[model samples]
Target: MDAPVRFDTKVALVVRADLAVWQKLNVAAFLATGIAAAAPDALGEAYVDGAGRRYGRMLGQPMLIFTADRDQLRAVRDAALERGLTLVPYVAAMFTTGHDAANRAAFQAEDPDTPDLVGLALRGPKKAVDKTVKGLALHG
Candidate 1:
């Protein structure tokens, strides 16, 4: 049997609990992209089947997804930031924008101190990430 793998860093996504099912999925997908971009090392080697068909790579480590209320989402963002960890946020405005530029503009317009965050993605040291997400339940 293959030995277990461990990661020193952790990736997490926290989505607004009040969002619709579709919205939750959208937020998760978008935020995951940000994590992948920020941490290239997070990705694992591509796969090949028995017939030699190749498949795209995926995260080397498991990503934990958590659901939180609007207030909790803000708190989580703040906590991560306070720890000097980088955060990739998806504001409510991004949903209405179609392109990357518009999405960025919408993000810039929000209050930096308290954004209307629908979701957030973060990658950092395991302990820091764990402390940042403490008390949060896993998303189903």
Candidate 2:
């Protein structure tokens, strides 16, 4: 037999019961739990080829899915859907570009502004020269 107490501390105790259980979780586990806890209001936006294709911003339990090509995009989307997650396609380039706006913009225009050779390789070096003759015209 148990007696019901009319006290505000009852609710606090009930909520805090799981506190110790959660405190032992690692950083990755904590982050995953936090995401799951906040999934009710999280959003998933897709950027396709530098354009916003689909805006599933209101969807709950949102997750970002990105790829470099159409085939890879299809595979990623299917895998996500199979895992009970929403499928949204976002271009990897655009997502990465968000980190460095200036360099991305310059690269998009075929102009190499960043000192990163890899970035130049990814975006290509065609835009740096107006014409093939001018581009091929070597400077000594």
Candidate 3:
């Protein structure tokens, strides 16, 4: 069999630092979910206990967290895109605003105005990710 698939690089989940505590948690969870959805293999398999309890954990790759505001977030997004890095963006309206309203606005709106990005998860070569997120401070 081929060697087990491994994520040999670092992953990052960056969030807006100015958000409320609840919003920070929400953004973190959503950002991680986006990464998990996009790169399931980066996560390890689930575990089972003798009692048939199940637990799951992320494996191989370790994630680094960072904090940034709206302008910084936009800059990172643009830089990542320009560098051809893979990014999963979490929008503020989707989590802070009501879901139905956010969805309707997103789908029904005709204008191309950009939504507010609350968080982002990026996975790729270590150098590329680092370059894309350079100068960003860690989340407090």
Candidate 4:
């Protein structure tokens, strides 16, 4: 059988560190979902060890975290778009009260005004990802 394909790239989830703990967690989860949807191969597979314990490895894929404010987030979004890079953006409605309500809000909230970007997940060539996120500091 042929081996499973693996991506030789880097994944980064840049988020606003100033958000509340819950918001941060929500952003991270949404961002990861974006990466998984875009690059499933990068996630690798689940395997069992000799002791019969199962382990889930992130495939050793590099996932760098960075912090940015509202303006910085917008800049990153623009940069990603300009570079033709895939961007998974988390919007304001994602922090809404309920799942159904959030989805409704998000659908209604989509407009030309460009909803605020709370978080972003970008994946591509290592050099490309690095360049796109240049000048951004690592999440503290």
Candidate 5:
């Protein structure tokens, strides 16, 4: 079997039946960055080359993944979860509330679980990813 061409992680492919969930939701994508300057030894050169791209690719969108070790995942998740409270809402508030506005509808319907799922969605299909970068820049 091949290592699947996952949008962000292995979990996403299973959760998404078609690509519609990803298309409809505004996701905040996050990847697991290995230890940073705070722990230079752990976040050494190897970690930088591999994990940095993974981390940077998903950070601005609406999802999170544990691509690295447990420690790195915990640190990233803790910081991100804290940041997410403010960050997620701010991103959601960007959409205009109108009948034709699917984005707004999704945003309005967000619960904690959905928002996290949305974050994953944002990290999806190449086009959605392009939009996520643009959206984050617009709001950030």
Candidate 6:
């Protein structure tokens, strides 16, 4: 077998720890899309099965998911920004939003200084990402 490939960059998703199971799942899925949009290069090529059926492409690199409390989530967001990493955030208001426009409006209504973040994702160099998520535990 060949040696495992190593990625220089890391992808991480962090969700507020107190959310319900369904909310966590929703947040994770939304956060992942943001990472995909920001890092198109990370997407692997589409796949075809034996019968020539095509499948959607996925991220070539692994993404770590973590759980954090409100304060911890804010800190992680701050750290990601401080390190100049690509960041995407999902605010609590987004849960009530029915569409993209409403979501945008909800996000916009948030204070620029401190959004009421329910979850966030980051894409950056491995070390920086590590530091940003330090002390967070993997989602169970």
* Best-performing candidate as measured by TM-score: 6
| lDDT (Cα, tens digit) per residue for candidate 4, span 1-140 | 99874556778889986899888878888788778878777666788899999987563475778998888887888888878777888877667646756765784676635667779889877778788899999987
For model 4, the stretches where C-alpha displacement exceeds 4 angstroms are: 1-7, 55-59, 100-108
Q: Compute the lDDT for candidate 1.
A: 0.93
Ranking by TM-score: 6, 1, 4, 3, 5, 2
Positional deviation of 109 in candidate 3, in angstroms?
4.8
Question: Which runs in model 5 stand beyond 4 Å of their true positions?
Answer: 1-78, 84-100, 113-140
Q: Per the 3 Å backbone cut-off, how many clashing residue pairs does candidate 3 have?
A: 0
Better of 1 and 4 by TM-score: 1
TM-score-better candidate, 3 vs 6: 6
Higher-scoring candidate on TM-score, 3 or 4: 4
Comparing 3 and 6 on lDDT, the stronger one: 6
Superposed by TM-score, candidate 3 places the C-alpha of residue 45 at a distance from the truth, in angstroms, of 1.9
Q: Tens-digit lDDT track for model 3 on 42-119?
A: 777788889999987664466788999888888888877787777877776566356656744753442324547778
Q: After superposition, which runs of candidate 6 have C-alpha atoms over 4 Å from their true positions?
A: none
User: Top lDDT: which candidate number?
Assistant: 6
List, in order, the clash count of every candidate structure.
0, 0, 0, 0, 14, 0
Model 2, range 1-140, lDDT digits (tens) per residue?
A: 78753221100000111123332122123233334444433333543545646543332332221112233323323333344432112222332353446534644654222211110001012222111112121111
Q: What is the lDDT, from 0 to 100, of the residue 75 in candidate 4?
A: 83
lDDT of 1 at 16: 94
lDDT score at residue 133, model 3, on the 0-100 scale: 82
Give the lowest summed-lDDT range of ten residues in model 6: 70-79
Error of 6 at 128 (Å): 0.4
Error of 1 at 36 (Å): 0.4
